[model samples]
Target: MDSLKKKEQTLKSSCTTSQFCFFCTMKEPDSPQRRAGLANCFKQMPLTDDQENVLVSSGLFHIAMAQPDDPEFPSLGIFECMASLIQKGVNDEMWLRRDQNIYIPYYAAHIIGSYTMNKVEFAEKAVESGVIPPLMELLRGNKMSWVEQRVAVRALGHLASYERTFEALSTYEEEVVRLAMDLASTCVDVVYDNFVGVKDTRRRAKYQCDLLTRGVGGFEMENCKAEEWTSQLQCWSLYLLNCFAYKERSLNLICEEGFLRNLCGMWGGLANHVSPAGVGLIRILCYSKYGRKKVAELNEVVESLCNLSRSSDDWQYMGIDCLLLLLKDTDTRYKVIDIAFFFLVDLVEIKDLGDRSNFGEAIIKVLLLDYHKQNKVKLINISSSKARKAVEDLWDWNVERRRKERAMSDEKLEERRVLVGLIKQQASRLYCLGEIEEATRKYSEALALCPLSLRKERMVLYSNRARCRLLLEDPSSAIRDSTRALCLSTPANSHRKSLWRRSQAYDMKGLAKESLMDCIMFIKYGCIKSDQDQTATKPRSGVKIPYYAARMISKQMDATWLFATARSRIKESDNQCGNDEGQYYREEIMMRKMMDNRGLSTIREEPLVVKEDINRRKVERARRISKRATSQIGLPHDVGVAEIQCGGPTKRDRYSKFSSSDFISF
Candidate 1:
């Protein structure tokens, strides 16, 4: 242990020249090494009276100088060390010194404020022994400098948070309250007098009011007649009243009689002094139930705020935020909305250039939702339509601006491509969820973000979006996108597919003949004309394209007209020839026509056509048997058969004939 003490001493002496301490090197003295060293040193020699005095004075000096880098730096930890030293009776003489500057004791008391848990006993002993009295005396002294007063008041507030200290102070509650009130009153006076000639008197007054409110509120005055007493003080009084009225206890007291009315009037007069956009005063007025009764006066004040809001275009944003508070009360909601509407519309129309679009839209959405809930249908519809048009216009403007921007920036083009891809994915999910309108919006956004360089991708997006729009019953937009997709097609696999989609859009819009023309083109270019053998009896691979393209063309097919024309075309070809080859050709043509009519263009000719033909013949044979059986059952031939007819009795009919006899015999 002695060796450890010597080693500690060596570390400390080495630290002295290094302009730091051994404890400072460890970052935290609570660390095992630092704590062990401190304990060992304490047990080894203990601090002599002179050494303790030196350490305390050095700690105090460093704290005063705000030198946290010093080895004996005065921090909360250092204060804990001092309290430990005092508790151990290391140096009672220095601890009890009166002329050592009240800062030392005041700081020590302030430090004690943090000791609410186990340090109550230590605090009680210190107060009982008169260590706290000197600090109190310094706090109440008129000659204390501002810095000293701030420190003392903060320390008192801290100590007041403790249960025992606060309870003990409760015995002298009246006296403490009177002292605090007096100090607050004097502090307000000093601030007014000192700041009277200042250029920024308003700001100075606010700060002074804040300080006084904090000081008085910290005392927790029970019988303090703050309201009646504060009525005569103009700027500072109104400020403090506003502050206190927000406090629960003070609000309970101030709401009686005509106190809230008079307070509201004073706040209005001081409102100009407060930052116009700053709602601190407005918020305080709106706090209590009593303030609700003075809606007219509040409205007047809010109306006057429009001037401040109009002072600068930027002020309009802040103005809207302030107006939102007034509208929060159901009674005043409509009045505030009406007053704010004109300003909002003007902001949107005139300042639609920058961030105003978002702000305007936000405010309009709130008003519309509220008005709609109140069943004001006309107002709701008007606002909704107006907002929708505004949003659409803003969207177009943004798209045009971004288009221009991308033209100037290659980096922006890449970013736009990535964004478009993400939007397309989200659009697909939304479409799957049956949110057609939202999906259409997302698809439009994707198209706007897509660069012209990605023409193939852009074409696919347009085609998909056209499908969504058509599902939404927006045929005009669907046709527009489809046309754009066809125009923008490139050599990618989806180009001819876009033509088929455009054909579907045309058919949906009642342009069937135009759609048929596109289908023929799709067949010529999109489909492969295999020359191997048109009359082959085996299945073969047909042209491969996207499924959506196939579906689209199938949807556009004029089933009655196309079927008749295909059958006639096949018969005419067969009539122009005379052999088994012509018959086979006719069969192949009929099969191709069948697959095309069913929108199954992927089927090959050789085996699949033969299998499908055999299935078709079996189906025809079954129909004939069903017709013959229905005739034999004496049912009208015009009536469709309802059961399978294999020229045998049904199980239900046969069982009905023998059920009783068979059961008895068994």
Candidate 2:
């Protein structure tokens, strides 16, 4: 127990010393307590790379979580201390050579790579300062284990993703590509050697070979083929060749070099390994620039794919997508569609009626419209047995979906009812308090909860809310809601209220002429029903008086020509019967009295027929002028009269003074 106590005290003291050293050397004191606490904790624990990583990660987290609002945060200091530790550990020769300490440098590299603060610069500095040499050396070493290589390779890939490292590595592109290829090649060879003749290893080697061939142009399939190569390798070879053909589009490489022939050869040997995805890739390559020149070779490959697509029941859907992509160019569209149509016809006759019917529907929907529209194919002879079955199946599915939807809608309706009731209650309260804006908002919320199918009720709610919006001086929203209300309303349901609300909204928006028309309609349709009800309730003796009174009221408020005539008559009557003229008639002698009484008569004068004829002539002239102004005369709408006629003489013969030659000169 005493020996353990002494060892613990020594560990605690060493950690304290390290903390003090970091603070002194790094000159950052922000997370000194956290650092000290972690160090002391480590003293009581076994020192493993994971435990050290926990401390390192804790430090990084503290730095990352520091906020700009906290004046006393030492995030920069923490990052500096962590960076220093990583640099020192990676650079230390003793640490790098120690077998047990290998994990330290590896973890350090990981930390450097993942650090959020200027990570790219830090990684570059580490690499440029030769800190990554040992790791790279281990990666290239013959005695290096597979696990170590995997780690190194992953780390390098991560580093390469960074822009700075990518730019730096671009200068040595050939070297980098060669190194990556060699590592992948070595991995492939090792897998093959270890497994002897195992199919799985051959498969793994094929995958590695594919990766190696990514940017390496000259590394072809012949160099990688071995006696142990399985169908998997052939698939990979086909993939690599397709990729190369895709990049260069070299007809020579595609045909003369036997790229498509080799790819097609693999179809028989590796049909199972070469799936629809692989086939699709080959299809794309064959339609590429280089592949287009080698039409015969391209056709052979496409024919092989089409055959596989037709024969393989497993991946036929993928084959359809490949056919669609290949047919995107106009040149191949008709031909590809023809082939696809044949396949679809075959699908219609398939033994599994359900799948056949479903596929038939999909093919018709995806292809028929395009084929018929572009190629003028009638599809008159197409099989209807599968199509009819598909439609029935689709109808059944729709019925089920609609049934579920109705049930969901019922639940939503119940929820909406409760929400609308709450909104209405709130709106009533707000309305009482003279908060019209808030009241209108609540009313709008209530209306929005109403189902669209209930047009009559929704129109009422929308019209009412629109009025409230208009009162709140929000004419745009008012107009929108009012318009919606009118659209929802039916002729049988009476849209007068909606029209009235819209008229109010339009009036508020400075559209008085439009508003007047709507208001007149509202008074004519909406008020007539109420007046009739009132007349029905009234005694028979009072009916005539009320009817006459309603007619007078209608004349005053209506926007028709009758109202204009009434207004003109009122203006004439007021002008003739002055107060002086009325009294003068009473006091005058016989002849003068007769003249005065004629002008100031109590009875209203009917408009003279001659005056009416003159007014009619003026209205007709105005209409003619308006029509002429609006009619097109080979000029744009913005062109002025001067621009249109260029100072032409009037039709009243103003040009009679001038000869045709003088007019032309002018």
Candidate 3:
């Protein structure tokens, strides 16, 4: 105790001017006896790295918790200290063990983010202090937790929000956007594996759990905390991506066609849902002519947006904005405008869009770009099955008369059904004669004329249309048509031909689970011929799956279980690539590179040997891909999106009042 006091006395004497304010004397061992003859609040003292880090963490904790008006919010030399601790956490695993060091980096980053949230001056201080690189380190670190990541992204976002610090963050542009993309793609799974998935309390990372519980409580709070953090991490990553998208940097990489298809589906768990999620990125991309051109060409992207425009999803208007941007320009208005305009017709009556600028008028203007009005049909209350007629039975005579009319209707329906069958026979002949486009059109013509009551004939036409779509390289439409056929069956999802065609369609879209399940269900409809309508959903015991179904099952199993397999389905003989058994050894490698680097890197710099291996793999990948260069490819959950500037919740586009010149009066 006497020697400890003497040591403190010597440290107090070593205090320097700059270090003085950044540090103050500590109660090293925390005992009242050391209070003897002490200055009570001793002057700042020089300290070693470990000692200084402890002080930094303490200051950061207090500052981060403090409101913005507090005097200590951006204290002297604090930015440099925070930046140093973050770099240490990224560079030195050993330092993380020294005196609450893990918390030091997190707290420091929080303080930086918190202070910079409302002020450009504090953000400028952060940029000048070299906070961006270390923050980027934590953002891109291989082993950092979501806790660290969220703070890093938040700080960078605040810094990126400002005009002065924006250029600093852009130094590592490709790396930053790619890292955020990978994070947005995999954060849910990452949180699930570590915090949510583990059942044993002892196995979970203690520091993370402590941070989640905020050094208190248990699992009950952890679930909610986990959800909140998961959302923040995903949102902030996209927010960072949005910062890039706002500036239009790396559009080629961001605009990768396959990535765009997956982007429309990467909607997150929860967010400042007012602006956008993945669709937010799409909207930003649509603003640019190059982005518009790319977005307009992808059939799947247009179809996905079309579906969203009609659904109850939050980003419905955002989807409309993307299609409008595409339609608003003539150079980019190609195939998708025709496809999307069909869906936007229903949205023409929508109002109260909050500064989206003349919602109804915008949709109408686009619709009238090359408009052609058509006559509409109105059906009477003569009742072709509303199912409402049963409740109002004051009409006993009406029922008997309707039953008598129904017999005549049935006989006429049979005649019409026969005509549909004859047309189907012609389509089948065209299909066999290699006139697939002609066959597809004939099937559509038959479907248009067929009555809704003719379920079986419509099922056949839909199944035939799905096959034609597959050959035409339009898997989205094929999936839609095949799904319709399955729903039309007596027992939903039971038609043998529909199941098989939908499975093939799913395979074409690179959806393994959907394809595999459909194949299993197809096999379950035991012994049914392609032409046979009398199929069962439940498999018969001791019945063998047919040769074709067996072959399909093999390919689907390969798709679901193995990685890096070929996905292109052959038209001539129903052949699928990746039947070669040699590529099966990459099950582990597939997880590592699945979604093509969708997973976050676990380390900062690859070692020489690892880099060499990557080079060799790239060559081999090039070789493999060249052989099947024409096949349709798909991206994983990791392809992504974000908002405009993610300063805070990356606020939605600020809609102007109707009085503004930007607002169109409908």
TM values, all candidates? 0.28, 0.27, 0.51
TM-score quality measure for candidate 1: 0.28
Per-residue alpha-carbon lDDT of candidate 1 for residues 75-105, written as tens digits (9 for 90 to 100): 1244444344333332244444433222233
Q: What lDDT does model 3 reach?
A: 0.58
Alpha-carbon error at 46 in model 3, in Å?
10
Which regions in candidate 3 have their CA more than 4 angstroms from the true location? 1-59, 69-72, 271-275, 355-358, 372-666
RMSD of 1: 33.9
Better candidate by TM-score, 1 or 2: 1
> What stretches of model 1 exceed 4 Å from their correct place?
1-189, 192-249, 252-320, 334-357, 366-666
| lDDT string, candidate 3, 1-666, tens digits | 233234435545565534233333343344343332122221121124534444446454664567744433354555776776677778888778765566667877887888788888888887888788888878876757788998888888888778888888888888888888887777766776667555467888877787777556665456546655776777777777788888888787778876787676565432233336678888888888888888888888887777656433346578778888887687776446557654665444344343464565567666555422231121122223231122122122224434644666667877878898889888776654445678789999998767655667787788778777666667677777776676566555567766777676676677654665576556445333321333356442223333334445445545544111112222213212322322232222322232122212111111111111121122233223322321323211011000010010101111222122221110
Q: Report the candidate with higher TM-score, 2 versus 3.
A: 3
lDDT of each: 0.42, 0.41, 0.58
Q: Where does candidate 2 stray beyond 4 Å?
A: 1-98, 101-143, 159-166, 178-189, 192-324, 329-666
Clashes of each: 7, 0, 1
Better of 1 and 3 by lDDT: 3
Write down the RMSD of candidate 2 (Cα, Å). 37.3
For residue 529, what is the lDDT in candidate 1? 37
Clashing pairs in 3: 142-602
